[model samples]
Target chain A: MGRAILLDKVNIPGIRAFEVYREHGGYKPAGKALLGMTPAQVQQEVIKSGLRGRGGAGFPTGLKWSFLDRKSDKPRYLVCNADESEPGTFKDRYLMEKLPHLLIEGLILSSYALGVKTCYIYIRGEFKYLVGILETAIHEAKKNNYLGEKILGTDFSLEIYVHPGAGAYICGEETALLESLEGKRGNPRIKPPFPAYKGLYDCPTVVNNVETLATVTSIISMGGDAYSKLGIGKSTGTKLMSACGNINKPGVYEIEMGLPVEDFIYSEEYCGGIKNDRMLKAVIPGGSSVPILPADLILNTAKGQPRLLTYESLAEGEFISGSMLGSGGFIVFDENACIVRNTWNLTRFYRHESCGQCSPCREGTGWMEKILYRIEHGQGRMSDIDLLVRIAKNIEGNTICPLGDAAAWPVASAIRHFRKEFEEHIK
Target chain B: MLKVTIDNILIEVEEGTTILQAARMIGGKVVPPAMCYYTSLKGSGGKCRSCLVKVAKGSAKDPRPIPKLVASCSTPVQDGMVVENTISAEVQEARKGVVEFLLINHPLDCPVCDQAGECDLQDLSYGFGMEETNTREPRREYPVVDIGPLIKLHMNRCIHCYRCVLAAEQLTKKRAHGMLYRGDTIEISTFIRTAIDSDFSGNMIDVCPVGALTDRSFRFKSRVWFLNPMDAHRECSHCSGKVAAWMFGNEIYRITGRKDTFGELEEFICNECRFEKKDISDWVIEGPRKIKRQSVISGNHYEQMKKGSIIHPIEGTTEPQE
Candidate 1:
């Protein structure tokens, strides 16, 4: 597998400043794209490359760019979602701390591709230290002519601002990030007027996750086809996965898409063969939002094929059995980790972060959490197990946004995939 | 102009409608229940199972899609889709099952609940609850909290409908509320503290599906049924926006986002709107009918306006100007 592009040299020497970065071909892509191509041409190249968002939505990056409300007279804004609040999803944090410039470079180029002049890096408020890291890098870039007014005599100018969240998890949702950036509450605005249309003070805006935007500089440098060649099928290109829990290397690891789940977890090089050499009980392939797969199911699919870790293969069935590659928050559990209790914890997070928006999610998430809390505390009844599943099913696909679905995924899938664990916990 | 029969009653409604919305078009009750449907928001927030109704496999004339009960809030009504919202014992049982599940963990704390007389869960339990719980397990406990300086919480009464959270996120133009925990252990909290001090924080207490998210201002003030609901729209003196203010005993206690308008987003009424009703420092005094002007802009302004009046102008002052 190819080493992560931005992460590869993150710890390497000569990767900090533009002098060091430029000495090792750092601004080559931005320079080449700026000097050699039009913004439309750059977007077309990415679209042609078939690169999808690494933010777990797996939405085509080029399409997302193309969807911008182009005719709008309002100023276009590029918002980089630095709010990495999803549990088990820590890859964005690593990128911000280690490879800030990589992200900054990506933001500039992606901004250019969208023809944006002012961009906002909506950092999660809890990343108090990261805000400074990003600020320092922006200052370094401004001093070196990377982010400020103009660069290398190009006809474009951009101003990047790092806006920190007030620590709400829903702020990660693109629209919610826009609301937070505008100094409004961090709740998501309604769609159809998706952020691409009217966002951040009612302007045409594009909100891309940190990893999703960082991939653009590579796509521009290598051309779309070369970047697309790194991965397989509709899910093209490499993804930076934060493979934590029960793994020998519980750190951020970038792997080519379509790598088998067993190989990613059990390989001596990757997760380093599940901790203590225990059996793999389940793997939350995407993040906490994706449904867990049993060791057998993780190794093979419903058709008896090995479960390939691509967007399609992992979420082929629907339900958590089939789920959105939601934010790449992969939490691993060994045979001993109770799927029920872990699900209860995740539900507790959703119930907590529910933003209380929509009835089913607010009431439904809280209801599911309470019942599961009871079951986990050892006062579980047979009916309580059924009640947990019932409440989750009720809240699924029925809210103002996907937060309700996010809340329901673990509960519905935990029961679907690990009904036995729930039954066992019922005393 | 699509036509469909609901429970053998033929009705005509616009095409591209949900059965619940279609049922509502005829001006009576639809047997299926909905929690997320704020009919003012076009009635489609299908997060609750109470709105489940069985639909037929094919034409409206034939009914044979067994177990095809779908949430009416989210499900769109098709031309030939047959709906059996109340025909079968099965539909009623499913509704009862859902209501019972909703109540199992619900705190029977309605006696002290501010929303006791008008809560949807209270009404639903009356209509469909079948659970007779003997389990002595204590109800979920949450310390009464001041979530926002304006919004008070008896989280124990929260059904977690998320209406308040959604309103805060989407309607109130702020992400003031969210779930704090996951699964049965999950709860609604302000992440760090319970206080939602946003100017829009008062909206949560109204959007709360249950008494869990209650208003500090209206808490234990009066039963909802005791207060006569007046259908009057008052202009927001602070802004051009009009708020639907509810008056209890000739005094306006609360105001909310009025959805009973044409082509307007459910604009959240801020604390200024909800609390401004009772903060009336002055009122116009009328003697049958008379014109008078009294100004307190400056100490002598009241006298200046009254200098030309036939009757001496009367003005009460809370503060004196220089």
Candidate 2:
């Protein structure tokens, strides 16, 4: 209804099959990219597309790919990060399960653009069934001369493999994912040698999200300039949002960027409003890591401008009043949902998932979880409130990875926005 | 060469030098205390966030300050870079928090621990920690298990520094113990309680920052303050055999690796030298080892005191000495 780019053909009866997907123009983009354009031309097109990463970070996709060490004689790698383990986010699973060829075609085009000879799709261990579906689609593509050595009568050749993780949430981080893929324990490596410089066996590697690669098919089919015209400003093209929690029609919806938050929540085209006619209390617009915004703040900014789903609009105010479009995980909460209890639950998840490589995250996450548990169980003290803030502040930017900040944000933001509820629990 | 300014003191170092190395060249309070970094061990520094410092300027070319405090042990210095260690209030507060995190699960049993006088955690807590702990949660505990006849494993006292694991891996032909499990519950243990019986495995006791890994022979020996550590060495085919013999009235209490100012071993000694050769007749003594003035072991020794200072009687009172 609202300009569906990815899921428009998602509901087709046999779209999972390679033949059915090809009948709807699945591998046309790969053919177009390989036969009609040079690798540099394809890169230039992606740079002009202005497509930011659909992953939580919202970094520019083309810019991240541009940072690869092209001058290095070592072979470059393109790692497709299918390890989507973030809570409240399942759009990558839906897209991969329903239309595997679309993702393969995108990978083919992306691999060609980067001159990559080999690539890997690092999916989560929990998504075991999706591995079979993706592998079947890849087999079908190779049988048709679309993948493997010398595709479409061109010099570009690529190989894509499916690597499953051992079910650790920290492996979703790019470096940790690479570490897990390399058959090591999944602890995140330190920075200064970012994945772009020396990653995946100490070679230049670029890790992109599943949806970020799948969107490349559409960008290649329609030129980059045309794709740039779709969304507002820098957040161009369509985004896949997996809406859950209290919404009536809760599922993955591919909405064009710049859609008003109110219409997207209330309209029949998207969420179909809250269930049981319950009053909306708060919403974690991104994944569980992003800040929880109250009902009023989720729909409009502090200056009363109508909030949209674009990166700039949602982040109009900093973290004081704003949240990110992180992986497009829209979790809604009704009045019955206790902020203290939910914060405790999310903190427990972070605490359980921390790799314990560094100090701040390894201890701070568990410390916050304990404090939140005490508060939720009605055994909290008045001084425990500020202690949580202090602990979260110390952990926010002091660890080896972003997991520390991720573990710190929910507790800090919930206490900042819902301090009254915490006080009531203590009382 | 690169020019770097740390706490307003300018110094030039080679191109590949780290910020921690630069600060160590300047020495004194400017050097950040490192619990996990060993100059000889590779890939051992960044896991322990104890050496975090603030980068006020990225470099001369890109002057944007690094937003987050970086672990100085791993970050390479850029030309015209500016760093802040002891001078930054932000760094001091963050370091305090790091110390608290490292101690939240630590069992404070310094009174009975064998590594009491020379433990790095003791020095770190004294320098950067608060007077009272804010955590009421119970400290994590693990049953004391002996890894071999010579080494004792106290999992409760480990700060997860991975130093022993690195020492065993780098020093021995095959390592038996490594970090098992993860995330606050992580412990340094062998697979299925295998005996760590390598030629160089005893060096794990020397590299341990806390009282986690200790010599079984030296367990419950005289307190380190009462014994005089003498620089001693012996010829051996296995290793450099240089060590410090803790002497108590002509009897050897224990033999340990001769440590430098920052608590790192000058040369890793063999298990034969450390555990088997304990008699004072086995080695030639050089002299009394010069302990750092701040160490608890330096307080009671006579040579460490001023040359002309008069010895006061322990039991008798001298009230009239002006």
User: TM-score per candidate, in order?
Assistant: 0.71, 0.97
Per-residue CA lDDT of candidate 1, range B1-322, in tens? 7677777777877766767778776544554656656554432355456777777654555545634456676666666666777786667766765675567668887887777755678778878876576334566676655566566777777665556666666654556667765434457777677457666666666566677766677767766544323333445554434454443434555555443211122555667766656532222211111112221112323222222122222332222212
Interface RMSD, candidates in the order listed: 5.8, 0.9
lDDT of 2 by residue, B231-292 (tens): 78899999887899887655788998988888889998888998999887898766678778
Cα displacement (angstroms), candidate 1, residue B85, comes to: 8.8
Q: What tens-digit string does per-residue lDDT give for candidate 2 at A281-373?
A: 999998999998999999999889999999988887879999889999999999999999999999999999999889889888988888889
lDDT (10s digit) by residue, model 1, range A193-220: 5778888898988888899888888888
Name the weakest run of 10 consecutive residues (lDDT summed) in model 1 chain A.
A184-193
At residue A104, candidate 2 shows an lDDT of 93
Supply the global lDDT for candidate 2: 0.89
Report fnat in order of the candidates.
0.10, 0.65
- Evaluate residue A311 in candidate 1 and report its C-alpha lDDT on the 0 to 100 scale: 84
